[model samples]
Structures are given as C-alpha cells and as structure tokens.
Target: MNGLKAGLAELEALIAAPVLGGCNLLVCPPATLAAAFAARAAGTHVQVGGQDCHWQPSGAHTGDIAAEMFADLGASHIIVGHSERRTDHGETDAIVKAKAEAVARAGLTPILCIGETLAEREAGEALVLIERQLAGSVPEGLAALVIAYEPVWAIGTGLTPTVAQVAEVHAAIRAVVGPGVKILYGGSVKPSNAAELLAVPHVDGALVGGASLKAADFLGIAAGAA
Candidate 1:
C-alpha cells in the first residue's frame, strides 16, 4: 500500500543480487505489483507474494482479493492474519484460518501471522494471547508452514523487544507449534537489528516491514539471514 509502480525499480535490484545460500529471500508487495514483481523474480531466488487475500475462491467480495487470484498472478504465497488486517477489517481467527485454507486451495503457501496487542502485552498476557491466536488461526496439515509473530506494539514504531524477550516468545511458539514449523519475528526488523533477531533461537526468519522498501537495507538483512 505504500508503493507506486514506478518505485518497483528500487526493489527490482533485488532480483540482480546473487542468491545467498541458506537464505530464502522473498518480497510480498501489495496486490497491484504482485504479478509484475513475480515476472521480474522468475528463475531467481527471490519469490514474490501477496500482502493479503480473501477466503472465498470467487464471489461478490467487492474490494477483497481472492487467494486463487494470487496464484493466477504468479504469487507463491499470501500473508493472512496480519495485524493491520485484524485491526482494520475486524478479521477474526476463524476468518484467518479460512483464508489460510483458501491460500492452500489456490496451491499457494500461506504465511499465517499472529501477534499480541500492546494492551495484551502490558497485561502480561502476550504469550497467552499469541497462543490463542495460533491455535485458532493456523489450520492443520500446512507443510512448510510459516508463522510470523509481529507484536503490534513494535511494528513500524522503531521499538523492538529485547533479545531475551524475543527468545522467550519464539521459544514458546516453538513449544506449541512444534519444531518442524518455521517461526519468524516481524516487529521493527531493520538491518541494524535483523542479525540479532535472526540469531535468536526458534527465530527461523523475519517478516520484514519498512526496511524492505529499500534495496540496500533489505539485502543487508538478507545477508544476516544468509
């Protein structure tokens, strides 16, 4: 939602970067740029995905984008249950679960996002809240499942959890979701902090935000992951 098509060139440079081993670089732009991004990323290590999608395959959903449409547009993944979607659209865990299933139905992967709000965190219920969201939002049988834990308080605020705090929640997520699933931390993940966050145990990767808009910053973070 923050970018215009002309700005695509900034991210297009990512396509030319050497494929870093052990790092799976991906860029999930707003729906409008998905196909164009996918076209540029074809045969490269970078994979393009959708920011969000609707649960229904097709119908009168008005402004809502469908999961199947993402796949048709060459998107390999679609992010479901983002905090913004939850807050702005009043999407519930059940709705997120349905959307995950919808992404799977479209033969695309689902990056199911779950997190706790500032109130929930200050109430000392962050873990509990996330666990509930995880239980309710994630569907079964999602192989190579990707779950992004983006604390609502930290997103785009330039505020991040301490390494120990991140470790604690990520470990908790691993305990419940098991070891096979990949869990990513998503709050304020800038190049400066990406290395530390990626180094955290149970922190499989990052669901980068603002920094991703810049090629240098995003690649620097990818270098850390690599």
Candidate 2:
C-alpha cells in the first residue's frame, strides 16, 4: 500500500515535469492505486498500469485483483511473472501464463517477465532457464503480450549484465517470441546504463524499477530509450 502511494506520487510529479513532456511513460502501480494514478495521468503522456492481476475475473479468491478490474480503472497494461512474484509468491510459469491470458481477455497488454537467478547464470544455464520460462509462461498467441528480460541477480543489486550479454539474451528471446512481440530489458536499469541497454538488439524498452521511482531518473531512462 505504501509503495503504491509513493509510486503514484512520484509518477504524478514526473508527469508534471517539463523535461519529461515528450517521453512515453508507463507506471504500473498496485491495483488499489490504478484508478487514482490513471486519473492523475490524464492529459499527460504517462500511462497507468497494474503490477499484477488474477487470472479469474470474479471468483472466490480472497485477495486477488482481476485484470478486468484494472481495465475498468483505466489500466492499459499489466505485468505478470515479475521476479518478486515468482520468488516471493511462488508463482510458476503456468500461473503466469494464465494471468497473461486473463490480461488479454480483459483487453489489456501483459508485460510478461522472464529471467534467471545468479546461481543459474553462474551455472551457464541462463538461456536454458529463460527458454523454459518462456515456453511455459507465454501462450501460443502473443500479440497482446510484451516480454521483459530481467536478470534476477541484477534487479536491485546495482549490478547488470554486460552489453554483449544483454544482447545475446534479448536476441534469443526474440527468436523464441518471434518478430511480432516487443522485448524489454529490466534490472536496475538507469540513465547511466539505459542508452547502452536500449542500443542492444531486440531491446525495445525497459521495465524499470528503482530508477523508475524518481522522475529525473525515469525520464532520463525514457530518453535513453528514445
């Protein structure tokens, strides 16, 4: 709840900033803040989204928000299978696949996240991990989905893979996802590294985190993407 409020406040400020006037920005806050942020983002370039959603539209789930609810609140996008959800909530690829289908059913785009942990990377199984995740997490029809490659070890660790490494993984993802889908890179992406990361082949944009919490940083990253 606190994070959602803080992120919405930050997004409000960023949208108001003159420097970020021309950038394409999307902020996926918690579902509770989706409506508020969408209202606040009106007349601005910033687009509001949801951090996650339940596959079922309306059901017996006690604490789950549905993608249709987010859509009703004006969310155009929703993220699924973020590393935090995968690790902290024990969400598997099959679950994420369901969520992605729900997002599509609700008429929203799903930004599906896929990545490998440090141990997996060290074992030289990063690509294998990504392939498995992709195969299981993504559905056959992917036109309504976006893929984000966020190395779990790099997220919030102030560490990132090299440009060559980023390019390699992104290319492999593209090959699997085919030419229609857009692939994004996420993992401690900031203005400092945004340009280089965006320059990598198949990297369409970013699913920023820490840097996204700040207006200057987020705008800088957006500019880098441009």
The local lDDT score (0 to 100) that residue 204 gets in candidate 1 is: 87
- What lDDT tens digits, residue by residue, belong to model 2 across residues 112-172? 9999999999999999999999999998866778999999999999999999899999999
Whole-model Cα lDDT of every candidate shown, in order: 0.89, 0.89
What lDDT does candidate 2 reach at residue 124?
99
Per-residue lDDT tens digits for candidate 1, residues 29-116, read 8777888888878888889999999899999989999988888878888899999999999999999999999999999889999998
Off by over 4 Å in 2: 1-9, 18-23
Residue 54, model 2, lDDT = 95
Clashing pairs in 1: none
Q: Cα deviation in Å at residue 215, candidate 2?
A: 0.9
